[model samples]
Target: MRLTPRIVPLLLLAAALLGAAPAAPHPVEAQAPQASWSWPLEPRPAVVHPFDPPERPWLSGHRGVDLAASAGATVRAPAPGTVVFVGWVVDRPVVTIDHGDGLRSSFEPVDSPLALGVEVEKETPLGTLEPAEVGHCAPAACLHWGVRRGDEYVDPLQFVEDRRPSVLLPWAGPP
Candidate 1:
């Protein structure tokens, strides 16, 4: 009844108006820069389609995501960055990196032999994955994965992981 600090913000505003649910769960401030990044698709590939961006800027969302991956797999380099671009677009095969300050990612149908400035690091590979009738995850095979900074369109799974938004915490067990 006397925890001080103004009674701890009125007991956190009466536990947010009595909804009360928070035994621990805070961290979630990374737009990019916490463990850098990874997972261009290796032992961890299965999103199928997410990142639905587009509130304006021409509409038709789905900015990026769609992991699955199988046709040719490989496709690495989720961090270090350099290979500015690789090829194709209107029909598939993309690639593109440039992870400097303005961060970029892009990977599409991918087939890259690793040209165009070439630097890469994080995972390296950066090729393969272009079979399933050239992307769009037709019968399966995926790997769209896109991220940008200069033009916007973020949420490449918030850089490798921690998509956040699952805070239940409040049941110490022994009920």
Candidate 2:
């Protein structure tokens, strides 16, 4: 059991074999906290565009989802939060809500009457969808919804629905 010369080669071989084995895959963690958040649009508008984040921070990519909505349709808050911003970003109007815990939601092209510092509850009417020609789906108005955790943008759909990928289980023939 001591460090004898004859036992050294066997110990080295065992160490090499253990190191060569593949490591167990790490579990994927949910980026955002689970909440009972709802869709901002009633009847649940269609997702015209989906989240496609850029590989790098400064790269060009679709950072949020675009929902098909009509011009002048009422847009509501998906969860309880305080209005942190209400103004025009670039060529379209925007309303941003701070939901605490470093989570913030922003909706663009929304003609919000709500002022900054105003508290909003789930489903509260934040504003109406404003017609914009600069949106990805131009000519037809749509809502651009985005969420952020700190500085990192996250999938807004994760707030409204379970974002877990569907897994196929082993088939049991007679179940």
Q: Which candidate comes out best when scored by lDDT?
A: 2
How do the predictions measure up, each by TM-score? 0.28, 0.78
Worst 10 residues of 1 by lDDT: 26-35
In model 2, the Cα lDDT at residue 165 comes to 66
Residue pairs in candidate 1 whose N, alpha carbon or C atoms collide under 3 angstroms: none
Off by over 4 Å in 1: 1-59, 62-69, 82-98, 106-123, 126-136, 154-175
How accurate locally is residue 122 in candidate 1, as Cα lDDT from 0 to 100? Answer: 93
TM-score of 1: 0.28
lDDT of each: 0.82, 0.90
